[model samples]
Target: MSDCNKTDFTNPSTFILLGIPGLEAAHVWISIPFCTMYAIAVLGNFTILFIVKMELSLHGPMYYFLCMLAVTDLVLSTSTVPKTLSIFWFNSREIDFSACLTQMYFIHCFLVMESGIFVAMALDRYVAICHPLRHSTILTNSVVAKIGLAVVLRGIMLVLPYPFLARQWPYYRTYIIPHTYCEHIAVVKLACADTRVSSYYGLFMVFCVRGLDMIFIAVSYIQILRAIFSLPTKDARLKTLGTCSSHLCAILAFYIPVIFSSLTHRFGHNVPLHFHVLIANVYLLVPPMLHPIIYGVRTKQIRDRLLRLFTHKGM
Candidate 1:
């Protein structure tokens, strides 16, 4: 077994993030759309957090989970966009090796954290839908805290090794990453060492966190559906389904693009490099931007409160 720590790194000083290889001429034009989307994502997720804080009535398991989601969205987007935008807008692409690794660590950590929170939110929805009477007891403050801690720890445990692993691998060639962000795969691909171990470990972590959680979430909803149909009244069914609409949309918003983007990148040989990078960027950007909008539209409390908040300022 070759140890990466003992290996030498060629050009160990800095890495160049080449923003969209062939489309370098259009970077300024591209920054417009990217910057707009980033602004909306930051503002939208921030508003969700602020509203949750202001509305004391929202101090429940459902909203508490949403708060966690919002915070994760904020951090997740923050991990990549500013640096990405800097590259696009200013051409300031040189990053110190350690800083690059640090950025990569946070990006992977926050991404896993975001996915874990969705699973937590799913369980919250399941409890609220399937066992309404016991929901409060089951998802108590203590329980929520425990779940939140677990989600954070899961991210920490899984992602901590990624940067360390990448750092140990010696880079003898170009330190230029073609994409906007410092992803584990992108960075490791530049290493002179064989990446089989790091690659497999990353794949395993993805399966454990996102894949397993997705499976559990599916089962939870299946059980929730069974419980919902067993309700005696039509209003009860509609009311319960209404409560789940926002969460269901959130699930779709978070997963659908990721699945599509992942599939295309892994399997689509004919796909253009720029197109894949763009799709990948969208996968990260769209969720946080849509989180508040989806919840605000589907949730009457958030919608009405936001309306009141704006209307008050006008008066």
Candidate 2:
């Protein structure tokens, strides 16, 4: 082995990120859509936050949870997209070792927090639909604040170990990450040491965060469905189910991509590298882009308020 190869840059001062293994030539073109999606995510999520904060009528647990989801989406997408854009636009791919870990931490941190927010939103829907009379009392401001704090803390605590564990491994193999960002598995895969622990912990974190949250969301929806079906009139059932459409769409948009990306990363060994990278990028970008659109279009209150706000400004 060459002396350079033998040298243990236990932790390389910096790592090089290959935008997309085989698609570097098309990076400029690919960035267009990614940039657009990110723009929408930023604009739409901020709009949700602003509207929710200003609209007295939207002062409720449901809107509060929407605000949480919006913020999480913003952080989650922001964690990766700007760097990816720089790589595409300026060929800037060198990320500092600590910065890589910071990116990984925020990416996973807000991701888990987003999942928790989804669960909280699911419960909010369950209460509003299943126990209409007690919705306000059950999800009062105090309880909502507590849930938000718990969600934030849970994300911080659960993902806190990712960086610590990854830091232990010596990246002696190669510093060239063949993807846009410092994805935990991607970064750790370069480490010369045995990675079974980090890999296993990552899987455990996924199950504990996404899997368990999914199960809870599923159960909440089940009860919600039962409550909807129990209603005496078809119209009543439809109206109640309608109330959940936005949340359902948001959940599907968020989790389906996440599951697919995680599975492909761990198990889809046969999948092409570019395809995997593309899917991963899409998973991060799509939810944030679609979330506000879903809620704005499906939630009548938001849609109407938005229309009125725009119309008033136009006039």
TM-score result, candidate 2: 0.97
List the candidates' TM-scores in order. 0.94, 0.97
- Candidate 1: count the clashes: 0
What tens digits encode model 2's per-residue C-alpha lDDT throughout 160-254? 99999888777664689999999989987888777898899999977877999999999999999999999999999999899999899999999
- Model 2 bad stretches (over 4 Å): 1-5
Each model's C-alpha lDDT?
0.84, 0.92
Error of 1 at 100 (Å): 1.1
Q: How would you encode candidate 1's per-residue C-alpha lDDT over 256-299 as one tens digit per residue? A: 87777766765787988888788778878889888989998998
State each candidate's clash count. 0, 0
